[model samples]
Target: MLGYIARRLGAGIVLALLVTFITFALLSTSFHDVALTILGPAATPDVTADLIASRGWDRPLLVQYGDWLIHALQGDFGESVYTSLPVAASVLQRLVVTLSIIVPALLLTVVISTFLGVWSASRGGIVDRIAQGISLIGYVVPGLLLAIGLVVVLAVQLKWLPATGYTPFTEDPAAWARSITIPVIVLTIGGVANLAAQVRGRMIDELRRDYVRTLRTRGVSTGAIVIRHALRNAGGPALTVLSLEFIQMLGGALIIENVFALPGYGSFAFNASLQGDIPVIMGIAAFGVLLVTVVNLLTDLANGWLNPKARVH
Candidate 1:
């Protein structure tokens, strides 16, 4: 198990390096324009040239990447072109806001989806049909539309929560929860729908397997067989679905952040991309790759734990 975990971590590190290298290579090509954007239209050509040289944008791509990688490893991602703020600092600050929504929403999604999925699969009648209907409704409703509807009914009309703006949790935990409630709900709906369906399908399949019959014949209680054996087997696919949903939520945060006027990495990254803020963009890209690598590694570990056969390969 230790060796398996080590191998998975090593693979994730290699993947992160590959992704960062490719991202750097792609972003470097248009870096000259970034220099121009920083200088603005009033700057002379000589100024732009000097800016490029000073920033090492005039260097060979490999040299630039090497320099960036060295600084990045030291936690110095350079300064934002427009803000002059350290890229890592800015990103990390916003990351907190983003995760506050994503983490809680993900937890709720997993718990609620697991219950509904398992119950539906086990009960199999009106419960199954109702669960399926709920899943379909969640899957089909676009998040933006749902958010708008919620805001109108709950915020505007009802005056229960703020329609926009974020409060730091440290300052006011209750207000913070109220501010993010709508956003979390919008994000969780899709995940619950998708993951619940996957879990239901997998659980149903696992329950019908011959091992389940063998367990029954061995005099194991129905609940024990379902919970201890079938659920464990079904969990592998559910965890895979969950990891993918997490990645989707990260992307989904961009729109949600903008809509709700929250200070988060998604909105920051989006703005940086539009302005071609290379340092900020690179920092976000590296962070994203690192996050994905970590998530995949954890997923592999969980799968290995749930099914020992997974560790063999």
Candidate 2:
């Protein structure tokens, strides 16, 4: 187990390095005028040159990357070029806000999708047909459009929940849930539908296997066979989907957040990139690599646990 974990960590580190490198490369190539953004259009050539030199932007790309990486390793991401705030503090605060919504939405998605999937698979005919139809519709609709439509109906027309803004769960749990309810529902609808389809397929396949028939011949109940035997076997893939969707929600929350006026990492990244805030952008990129690596490792661990025969190594 220790060896397997070590290997996973090693691979994660390598992947994270590659992602950070790519992010740095893209930012360097695309936004080469950090000095101009900092000094403004009215600044003379000498002024921009001096500013760039002072900021070490005039150094070789590799040298600059080395300096940044060294500082980042020591938890020094530097101050944001745009806002002058510490990059880590700014990013971490927004990340918390993003999680306040995404974490609940993820749990809801898994529970809802799992139950629906198992039901549709166990009870065919109308149940399966309806589930499939709903899945298709949800999968086909764009997230932003769905969010807007939901907001217009649920918030604007009915006033069931707030249309925008996030309240802290620590401060007021009920209000927090209410504030995030609409966005969570919007974020989860497609994931739940898609995962339900996958789970349904897996469950159906497991139900038809010879062991399921043997269990039936031994007088095992349908519920026992489905829940105890089939569900476990079918769960590995569903778990994978859930993990992937969670990551997507984490990264994709930007659009929903912007529409809803939630302060989050997505919005931070958006503004940072737009303003060529190298420190914040680099910080976000590094944080992204870490987040992806950790989530993926968790997924692998889950998959391995679900399938005893599937060793982590």
Candidate 3:
């Protein structure tokens, strides 16, 4: 297990480095006139050239990347070209806000999907069909539309919760919950569809496996047979989908954050990209890539633990 974990961790770190390097190289090469973009077009050509030279924008891309990467390793991501704030500071602060909302949403997605999937799979026919139908709707609807509809009907019409904005949980717990509820709901809609459907299908497959039938013939109760014998192996593929959904929700968060006006990594990335703030853009991209890679590694570890057959392969 230790070796397995070490291997996963090593692979994740290597992948994260590669992602950051590739992102930095791509941004550097693809975009031109960074100094002018941030400095404004009205600036004179000499001023622009001076600004670019002063900022080392004229340096070879590799040297720039190397300096940035070294500084990043030492916990300095440099100052934001737009905000002039340390990139790491801004990213981390907003990252906390994002986690407060999205983390709960991810857990909720897992729990809700797991329950619905297991129940629906255990009982085929009407229950399965109903679960499938709901999953279909969730899978089909775009997150932006779902967020809008939820805001309109639930918050605007019913007034059950505040329609938009966020408050820190430390400031007021109730307000925090109220603030994140809509965003969480929006992310969960898609997450449930992604996770539950995969789990249900996987469960059905496991239930039909020869071992499951043998367990039943040994006089095990139906629930025990399904939960104890089938679910362990069945959960592996479901977990894969669940992890992917986590990453998907994070990506979709760009839309949801803007809609709700929550200050999060998504909004930061959006604004930074729009303003040509390369530092913040690079920071956001690296953070996201690392986050997804770590989660994928953890998912693999979980799958191996849940189904030991995974470890052998």
Candidate 4:
């Protein structure tokens, strides 16, 4: 197990470095005038040149990336080109807000999707059809439209939750929950739509295998046979789907955050991009890669536990 974990961790670190390098190269090379973008049109030539030289934007891309990476390794991600605040601090602060919504929604997605999948697979008639229909609707709908519609009905009509705003969890727990309720619901629906189908399909395949029959013939109860044997076997593929779902939700969060006026990592990144703030953009890129790496690592560990064959590879 230790060996397996070390391998996965090493792979994740390598992937992180590779992704950051690519992102840094693209961001660095894509712009003709980084200083002008940040400093604006009215700035004099000397000011632009000074900004360029001071930030080492005048240096080769490789040298700049190397310097950035070295600082990043020591926990310095530079400062926002506009606000001048530390990039890491801004990213981490917004990350907490994003996670507050994402974490709960994902937990709910897992529980609800797993149950619906397992139950539908085991009872293969009306139950299966209903579950499939709901998932299909969810899968077909765009998250942006869903979020807007939800805000209209839930917040505008019902006045049950706020229309578009975020409250800090530390400020008021109840308001915080209310603030995130619609966004979380939007994300959860999309997540369950994809993951439940994967779970159901995998569960159905596992249930049909000969091992399942063997377990049943051995006088094991139906629930025990399904939960202890079939679910475990099916979980490997389902876990893969779940991890991909998480990454998808993070990407989709940009739309959701804008619709709901939430101050999250997505919003932060979006504003930074609009301003062409290279430092903030690079910081966001690095953090995103790290997050993906961590998620993939967790999925690998879960898969290894569920299927020892995974560890062998």
- C-alpha local distance difference test of each model: 0.91, 0.86, 0.84, 0.88
Model 2 residue runs over 4 Å out of place are 30-32
Off by over 4 Å in 4: 30-32
lDDT order of candidates, top first: 1, 4, 2, 3
Q: How well is each residue in 160-244 modelled by candidate 4, as lDDT tens digits?
A: 9999999998999999999999999998998889888988999999899998899888998999988988899999999998888
Report the Cα lDDT for residue 233, model 3: 83
**TM per model?**
0.96, 0.95, 0.94, 0.95
Per residue, candidate 2 scores C-alpha lDDT tens digits across 5-68 of 8999999889877887778777776443777778788889988878777777767778888888
List, residue by residue over 1-313, the lDDT tens digit for candidate 1.
Answer: 7777788788878887788889889998887788878888888989999999998888998999889999999999999989899999999999999999999989999998898889899889999999988888787898889999999999999999999999999999999999999999988888899999998999999888999999999999999988899889999989999999999999889999999999998999999999998889999988998898888888888998998887755
For model 1, name the residue pairs that clash: none
Candidate 1 achieves a global lDDT of 0.91
Find the candidate with the highest lDDT and give its number.
1
Q: Highest TM-score, which number?
A: 1
In candidate 3, what are the lDDT values of residues 97-122, reduced to their tens digit? 88887788889888888888888998
Clashing pairs in 2: none
Model 2 TM-score is: 0.95
Minimal lDDT window, size 10, model 4: 29-38
